[model samples]
Target: MEIIPSNGEIFLGKEQSFICKSSVEATMKWLSGDDDEEIEDELGRYKKELIDETTLTLQVTASKVEPDRIIKCQAETESGETTNTEIKIRIIQKPTFVKDVSVTKVFNADSDAKLPCAVEGIPTPQVTWFRNDMPVPLLPGHLSATRDGTLTISKIQLSDAGMYYCQAYIRERNEIEHKNVTVTVNAAPMVTFEEPFPKITSKSNASFTCSVTGHPKPEIVWKKGEEVVSDDGQKYILSSNGLQLSITDLAKDDEGNYTCYASNSLGQQSTTLTLEVIDAPRGVGAGVVAGIILLIILGTLLAVDLTCYRTRRRGFLMFLSTSILGRPAPRVKLEDDLKKGTSDKSHVVNISGIDA
Candidate 1:
């Protein structure tokens, strides 16, 4: 005959077997826990249980064990009294991690910044960073990382300034967690000239300097109208002094206007200046008094010319007639000629007959 038990062993979770003859009473025993010695109630729970691995043959149970009455097991079996066999069992549980972790210090942009973070969880969770929901590049020289999990950014830029988040990953149980930090770089660079707009020019070379400054540093551009002026080997040159635009000769064309632009990852900022090329009066040797005197003389001459023209225009017709005719040789001779000549020709007009 063949006999089989679910596990070939007796245990509370696994099915066991019974083997006995003609329904007689019997008993069995089984080892429980890792203990080599009989398990005591103070140290363990659930007494050793024994079950027939073959056919249901033994009936066995005990209210107490030899070492400690407190250690207990319940078993029921039916068969004739026979020898008992003890069974063996084992006990253990899995590992775990902690929570509520965070970064120790905050960071800045364009400037070097770094910070370490704390992490805890089962299986040592994985970590990473994100800016505006996009994975930020943690490249060396620009960015780097530490073994304990720290993110560092070098030569930080305005664009680098924003809300940043850290992500932790745990594959087992498939868990993901996140933490966030916000950063601000600095304001836009300011552009200023050593001399204000409409700059005065001396015989010496003229210089227009843009004063540029900002965090993460900004790129500067100098422009004359739509055209870009070239300096250095390239059309553009950069410095903390802002974009320097130097022209050896100060021509009248250079006198119009110039512009300076400041740009960075954060955004863009700008300002403009209108340049006036005023020639420093030829020589101071003549003195300021001479210039003032010259201006006065020119003004007086202009006033005289205007007055003469106005007078002539006002009486023009009368003056012209008097010059051409010579005004009738003094009245007396005219009266004598009129009296002698008119008597013979009858100087009376027809209207004299109609009225006195």
Candidate 2:
């Protein structure tokens, strides 16, 4: 075949073989017409190289051929040529790399984000972070990259929340593998009073509670009417159970709204609990009550006796008309009685002998 060039490109003919560097010296002898044997005749007239031949088989990537990588032969033909002639190979840049990565789940908004990075040509690709399109600052505290190519956001607040991206770079290929992540910080919990406020006297024990809810457990702080009630230094007690706030031992001045502040790492929430204080009533002793009962009984008896006396003075009595010992009668002398009965009257002259 003659030399031919089309569109600034030279094409290798079927008859001419570009042997590899390993068999360069031996193949040069044949190209320079030093051999006139079976090898020469087999390559020219027979054209047996293209009959049952496959492309080259490389262990590494097609475009990543390096100095020490081995090129495998499919037929294992030990022709002693030390290289292949029919095999054709070329070197080119790697294809476009990792396009994107994502984190589907996160425990909390302020927590870190998980991102996966994948490249087209190779592993161990260099990773970089960006916001919108500009490169982000990689520092100790503000931003950090993980071993698995994930990004951990520390103290991610609402301001630091938004779309973020990661890029995988392979310098030789001019390839870029990119990923996008969305960050949302979970809001803090809120606390509130759900029922009637506690009412009590200085002499009585009083208790009240408030409920709180949010992503992270919120801390509660209570306050009296105008003064703040804290655990720092006071007689007022405040206790919380993540969801509840209880205050005990109410005082006289503990009236009005008792404010409660629920705070978390994300934000703060507040609520007011109206309180009413009452003064305890004074009680009477047992002895005083017993004397008052006695007086009441005596007054009832006097009224009953006066009513009975008035009824008896109405002259409601029965008079008997028979000759009884209670009748009024005149008395006769013993001499008049003796004159009526004369026979015995003369014999009774003596006082001892007189009979009536």
Candidate 3:
């Protein structure tokens, strides 16, 4: 006896048929596995047919068949000799996922995360990970996958949060299965500034603005030195959703290191900046007073020259000399003294004889 197409394989829940042909007329029967248990047609579990005196057909359901089972064809010839041919059945079970598996995972920044795909099959399937429809690269210390369909990512960041796809592939069977997983990563507060430290003048208000970013909206706190700053309406004020802290009526005491602290459920962060309070300017300086006095003196000298030109018809210097010396000597007397006085030139136009 010989079994046609000796190798037998079938997918789960499907039916497979086998034909056994004998060289001579004989009584044919089917037996299962090593025990040689006779296969019967009872309850329709298996179907058996005889098309001719030498050919026998047997049908079996894969779901009812055991792994690596052998179906043997036995032919008893009229000469009382038995001939046997057998085929081994290989059953293939498609990969299927277990029930009640979690598809979403949440983690904080800088933390480790894992996603598990619970699947089972006759032949183990290969598990791979993909992020945003692209394959996830497996790094030694960063991202990795396990044979049991679990993906792990180390030191996760905000950028790592997204949709992840887990696929179970059986290459030989040309079968594929996938599941979507959502990874959520939350971060702590991060503080930034446009102007790190500011210089403010005394007697003017000082404003320190803080820029912060985080998940779940972090809480903000302002501190001066070791003391917490609060809104007192007149002295301290907080606005712009508590991102800005303003100190009214600034003074020298306000100059120091001020801290802006931000915190969330994930973590906390802070930044410190110095507040420089310079003294406000005082009244007019000495240089300004000196310039004013110099301008006044120049105006007085110009006024005296104008007055002398209009009233005495003489220059300011000449008028000043006449006022210091007494009435001037007459021009005619001065000329006569030069022509007549030869004995005493000092007697020329004596001040005592000059006309008043």
List residue ranges in candidate 3 displaced over 4 A: 1-7, 17-26, 33-37, 41-57, 74-85, 100-102, 194-213, 217-356
Tell me which residue pairs clash in candidate 2.
Answer: 98-177
Superposing every Cα of model 1 onto the true structure, what RMSD results?
Answer: 19.0
Cα RMSD (Å) between model 2 and the true structure?
22.6
Count of clashing residue pairs in every prediction: 25, 1, 0
Please write out the lDDT profile of model 1 over residues 124-170, one tens digit for every residue.
66777777888778676887877655678787775676677777777
Q: Write the per-residue lDDT of candidate 3 for residues 173-265, one digit (tens) a residue.
A: 888988888888889999986787799889998777899887768999999899999988899999958899989999988899889999999
**Each model's TM-score, in the order given?**
0.34, 0.34, 0.52
- Give me the displacement of residue 215 in model 1, in angstroms: 6.9
Most TM-score-accurate candidate: 3
In model 2, which runs have C-alpha deviations exceeding 4 angstroms?
1-104, 107-185, 232-234, 240-249, 285-291, 306-356
Q: What TM value does model 3 have?
A: 0.52
Per-residue alpha-carbon lDDT of model 2 for 245-315, expressed as tens digits?
34445566656887777888878988887878787777998999999987875565455334434544222
Per-model RMSD to reference? 19.0, 22.6, 12.8
